[model samples]
Target: MSSPPIITSSSFSSSNPFSSLPEDVIRAHIFPRLDGCSLASVGCVTPELHSLSSDHQLWSHICHSKWPSTTTSTLTHLISSFKGGSRSFFSLSTLPPNHNIPSPSPSLSALPDQIISAVDIFYRGKCIFSKVQATETVSGWFKCSPFRIDLVGPKEAVPTPISRPSHEDTCQNLYADLELSWIVVDPTGHKAVNVSSLLPVSVERHWLSGEVHILYATVVCGHVTCSVEVTCVGGGPGGLVLHVTEACLKMEDIDGAHLNGRDSLVVLQRVLEGKRGNLCSENRKMGKVEEGRKKYLEFLERRKERREKILRREGRLDNLCVMIGSFLFVGLFYLLCFY
Candidate 1:
């Protein structure tokens, strides 16, 4: 019988269609289609793919898409600061850092008392808006709240219901309080500026859901104040997800101010008055008593569940201690009797 020819590794290598394509073609056509997460994963497969994935152009596209408000100057500064250029900057800016490191006890004094709001607006599940704002504003009405709508600003510090003690908890809670204010961030400058401060705005409650709706104006140029409307909704599994549903911007010329001048205070006063009237009309159609009742009931249910969990854990610890004490007593009695 004649010996059969063996299929070598070289034969399989030759079959890969990607190997035949030029590096430029792969970089331009193939890499562009992959998202940031997908691109990072693909880079691990081969050295050639790794080089193409690190291209600044790919990361620049991702950064702009995620943060449309980011200016060109800010983007350039961010890229220069990071070793991996735009890729490293984008990864650090968007995602939270790894929490696995061991550390000494943190001082309570060093802990941040004021909360920062990072609002991400999504349209049909796609992120369309993102901004970071500080909660400590001159207008006490604009501060962050534990709940979606805070008609009267909170008097005392309320424990955040959504924060988890550890990552091991299977059911994760979303930080809904951070959705209250819109803060625009400059990553390169490493600063957060409140969107409301730039132009005066008012937030009104949606009749059916009690969600907040904001109407504001921003200076587009020397001539105009761009009117914008923002709406927030509770979404995702466990009703923990909070995101912006709509953000519509329309340009209107300044009325009282100079025709070719940007006067923010003047623009703010005009927008607030217009939105206030609309809020009153919407409020009349809805029943206030029903809204308050439903919100209280939901709060009680969550509080009850939390209390029951703590009691159950205490009960287990008490039983364990009792068992140990009984065994110790029995051993001492047996020794005395034997002696």
Candidate 2:
């Protein structure tokens, strides 16, 4: 058997694959299937395809398709407000958040007066909930209180196919499969950041209440952390199906205290500008998730070290105080005896 000649980008002699296809077919049928990175790669192939791939509609479609929650009117407006429109927003949300670099965070004014959160949750590939929530950051109460964005109202719950589990094994079996994407948009900064770990870092079922809490977390700046907690309760038809009653984002410092609104906004702004540390960047290697988990572990260690330092400093202070008190007592007794 004879070997066939290798097919290169120019192998077709006169016309390439892109040149042979009708532009409409590629634009309408083909380009939409490619994700942002794939679309960028396709653009690099040739000049003709590059033009088609550059279509704002295609990038916008990719954004909407990946995160359905962006279709809301408010979210749509925010997306349009991004510097390069949807393409810029998409790039911001998908890139790795390089969070641990040693640099001062931006001022609170970097945050918009109003911020938008587009959250999506999936269990077993089915979208359980998608919502866009607006939060007021300009108020005094927000600046002084603990920072939190509640995606679900207290009275309502989003029902799911998952049933309440009677045993611990059954309850935790689905933790690894849950997916979440939480993108926070600051319209004033013209930037957005994905604060979700893309998968559950931990899932717990309340022992007495039986409420399942699925937690997606990202370690911010090595010492700080951002987390989205989905609290699912049993409900729907005799309370058999799992109902997600609450979903919220919370930021915490090394002491585990909830970051106040002012502090939280600063961290958020830094996260928006930080470099995404993606050490495990191989395909199917759980890229960002693994990196997130690793950073979380490091954060724990740093927290421990901080506590130890504080304890050691306090111990030294306590010893010094005791020595001073004993010396004063001895000197007073000697003076009284001598007199």
Candidate 3:
């Protein structure tokens, strides 16, 4: 302990350089440089350090910097390989439920809940409609004619309500011409023949009182002809009362094929007939009132004109009488002087 190990302030200062440096310089310079260098050596490091390589946000930035056009699925796959944890934590493979992207499977009956349920039906992402058949219960085999379709429903699906049919006892109106054009992509590369002003089949909804229902458009595949029939079961304004039916191309036909999983087209029709009826009724009542007001105004105008004319005529008659009386007085004075 001869020289006390030559204790010097310079050595202490060198050893504790970070203690004297500013916070920003330490974070900006030292941390990033250290982190970057550490990240570069991450793959060769221990298991704990390798797990940090799975930080998707950090890798996502790197990935975007490298392959800017990488798709979600690709990035997800790459991240999954680096990640040691379970797959559920960072799912790059699946899209958000709100994207409304259709799945390849048919077992999932309804669309994602986030999609605007009552969207104007689109076919293969096109907003136009073409001839095809849809059914309420899609069972085995059914036949349908070409037609346009539309819906008069809520912005979202609601439970079907039970109620008696507003009309008579037995008959039902199933479907109607939506007056919309149905466009189909020729997957077979055959040019689709354009039909000008084809008559649309009038379809109606069959509301079964106390039931939940939905409306869907058709996505055509292959060389199948389709048509839709709407059945209004028996529901009033407060029920889900519409039904759809579907028909497909025959099983053994590839000449015009039925492309599997073609989604339905959803068309937004004009205002509901019930609302339209109410509007018409209100318009008729308003028309009658307006007509009555016009008639009353005209009557008042005519009465005022008649009164003014009568007053004018009376004033003219009074002036004529005064002139006559003055002349008659002059004549009397002249006759009396001649006598």
lDDT of 1 by residue, 1-339 (tens): 332222223422557665777879877876777656566656666666677778888888866665553335544554556567667645444322111112333333332334333444433334444543433322334322211212122332222223222224322122212222233333323333223212123445555664545554433223343444555455545445444555433334433222311222223223221211111111331232233223334444555676788889999999999999999999999999998
Kindly provide the TM-score of model 3 when superposed on the true structure, using C-alpha atoms.
0.18
Best by TM-score: 2
Q: What's the residue-level lDDT of 319 in candidate 2?
A: 100
Better of 2 and 3 by TM-score: 2
Question: Quick one: best lDDT, which candidate?
Answer: 2
On TM-score, the stronger of 1 and 2 is: 2
Worst 10 residues of 2 by lDDT: 276-285
Off by over 4 Å in 3: 1-165, 169-177, 188-190, 194-199, 202-226, 231-237, 240-339
Where model 2 places Cα greater than 4 Å from the true spot, the runs are: 1-18, 101-104, 107-109, 275-285, 319-339
Compute each candidate's TM-score over C-alphas: 0.38, 0.86, 0.18
lDDT of 2: 0.79
Q: Looking at model 3, which ten-residue stretch has the lowest summed lDDT? A: 267-276
Query: lDDT tens string, model 2, 95-202?
Result: 546657566767655667877899988778777799988888888999999999998888998888887878554466676667899998887777888999888878
lDDT of 3 at 42: 40
